[model samples]
Target: MAVQSWTDMLKASKKTALIHDGKRKIHYLFKDGKEMAEEYDLETDELIVRKWRQKSTLGGQGQWQVEVGEQLASPVASSGSDVIKENCSNPVLTRKDTKTSFQWRIRNLPYPKDVFGVLVEASERCIVIKTSNKKYYKKFSIPDLDRSQLPLDCSAVSFTHANNTLIVSYKKPKEILTLEQELLQELKKLKGTAEGDIDCKTQ
Candidate 1:
């Protein structure tokens, strides 16, 4: 889907349903034999979990597969694969999450450390990265804070430049950590069955 018609798809989906679970809401729908489940924070209504599954080619029931669930530690990207686009290649942006911190890296930025500025826009609830040379600019927000209903903390945000990459990091809040742990447990309890269409809820 191109996203322009996502609303129409949502409207057209079969067996569309919503379930209230703790501080989160799970939405389920079926279309073309594929099922999608989304979990949103009831307070912010921000999506925290998304996953999809369909019929298994082998047998009876297909297991639920995650698309964008809780992020985990990722292997470092190879420098060869990071060279992406433009005559002057820009750093490929990547987000890496760990138990204690949320990190973002912009690769291929060859600028000096003094020329770059990383600022947390508290009112806007986003972090802005820009360069004095006007070569690059990026603005991103932390969905974990929004989903946990925690105020964005500028003091927790920091950055460093090394190996032609600008690394931005934010220490994870204790509340956010606890929320994730609880959410993971809750998610494990959700069961889905595809008889004719899909319906998912706590078993």
Candidate 2:
């Protein structure tokens, strides 16, 4: 005869169906829908087994009965209305409105008693200025600017030295293209010239 342990009997009692002979009750333990063991339960008949039932509340909440030995366990208490304070919530990122302004100025140079020997190279796209000392010459280029950005009238742009500073003055124009747009247009022209040169070499 095979002997079953107390732990085995208790585990089997969880899903066991009770078979009553009117004299003694038999609880059959099943694993995977196959009977594994049988245990005699004298108190299973005396103890109350609550049938599982579903209940609903006025708040539209549903509660289910737990299958305990004696009585049904109480439903968990609901936490009253969710109150979320804005300050306590996660921070939201916001993009601030910003204005970007650009200005260009030429500062004075050192050493020269006066601004002389200055050579100006002007083109439709830009102006190149070269100044020379006894030993070396320094070259600077000022790009063509939009007419709208000028100081108005803008008959002529002038560069001079005054108060130990190089000053540039121009008449502002009413409308002008952005510096970036002009640069891109220049780059496209350069690219086209480069491609033409390559095609000539390949030919």
Candidate 3:
């Protein structure tokens, strides 16, 4: 009997999945930063297995959008073997039942090569971009939270650039407190005036 290596053993035990009009033999083993898998095709020499990160909602329970390169693959299935991949980073994670909003400026930035990263709030989903330009502002309606938790009732947001860093401020009190405890401490550090109440800088 011939001696079999671990690689050979994994290749022999990989799970099979149909994709891109061909059957792919996927081994649930990790090697060389790539999952163990083999693609058998009659037309091409061999299919290359590429691994990349994907974004998901509900703590990765949601659907995944695979990132390929400059181009993204659609999730829609066409042929039996074709796999649809999407290109974009997943949104930041937050606690459930909490609404949050982010504000940023697109001015002077390069045209977005990937629009999947831009999320729409009202839609509570990601959208595709047709064109790229400066002065482009967008708002996203994220899941796991209500609109009331957002700042200014989901009104206009602002971003301040200072010392090569962007500072985002929210008009809501609870929202600001949720971001940092030090901020709340700073707010508490303010002193009251004798005549009336006055806002003071804690930091």
Candidate 4:
């Protein structure tokens, strides 16, 4: 049967039923003419669904649904858009890179103080800036990087000037490697450097 027809059948059925599509089996539960939950075996199917019963003690009956491909096409479609509109209308603040090496800048500083330190490295959605005495790291996005990069794992970021490399001590080595690979890829695109010319070192 069609997906929508299946959804309608589940919504109308007050009693729970099991649906077998040959490849997988799905348990559908309904309560008061509304779909309540759907359980799927992971070994057969990759998708699972769940429904939360709103208790009066926790909160009154909340508006919830169990459906596939039903997404909020607009902000106002799901809920009021007052907050979303206000946030969207606000001007995006970004760091201005004077050297023209990268499109990076400091954001959210007080007025009349737009000066920022040099950009050391730009990583996945974050950038590292070297201050007079220390290195400040901030998120990679231009609008979110107001002051400095947020310290990960409390260890400050270190940069090697010899090869223009950034060193960050991460608890998980795999995450560090992934970030390094992304940075290398970005550098290649920006500098036109070949893969063989880029060297990444991990300690």
Most lDDT-accurate candidate: 1
Query: Model 1: what TM-score?
Result: 0.52
Q: How well does each candidate superpose onto the true structure, as a TM-score?
A: 0.52, 0.23, 0.22, 0.20
Order of the predicted models by TM-score, top scorer first: 1, 2, 3, 4
Tens-digit lDDT string for candidate 3 (62-83):
3322221112344475655555
Q: Write the per-residue lDDT of candidate 2 for residues 1-203, one digit (tens) a residue.
A: 75563334334533423334421222233332322222223333222222232224454424433221222324446545564334423222111111121122333444353533443344333333334555323443322232222332323445555444444444323233343244323322332221223343531
lDDT of 4: 0.33
- Which scores higher on lDDT, 3 or 4? 4
Lowest lDDT 10-residue stretch of candidate 2: 93-102
Candidate 1 clashing pairs, residues 3+ apart or interchain: 91-107
Q: Under the 3 Å rule for N, CA and C atoms, how many clashes does model 4 have?
A: 10
Candidate 2, lDDT over the whole model? 0.33
Q: Which residue pairs overlap in candidate 4's backbone?
A: 95-105, 95-106, 107-146, 125-140, 126-139, 126-140, 137-148, 137-149, 138-148, 138-149
Instruction: Give Cα distance to truth, residue 108, candidate 2, Å.
Output: 5.2
- What's the TM for model 4? 0.20
The CA lDDT of each predicted structure is 0.68, 0.33, 0.33, 0.33
Candidate 1: worst-modelled 10 consecutive residues by lDDT: 191-200
> What lDDT score goes with residue 186 in model 1?
56
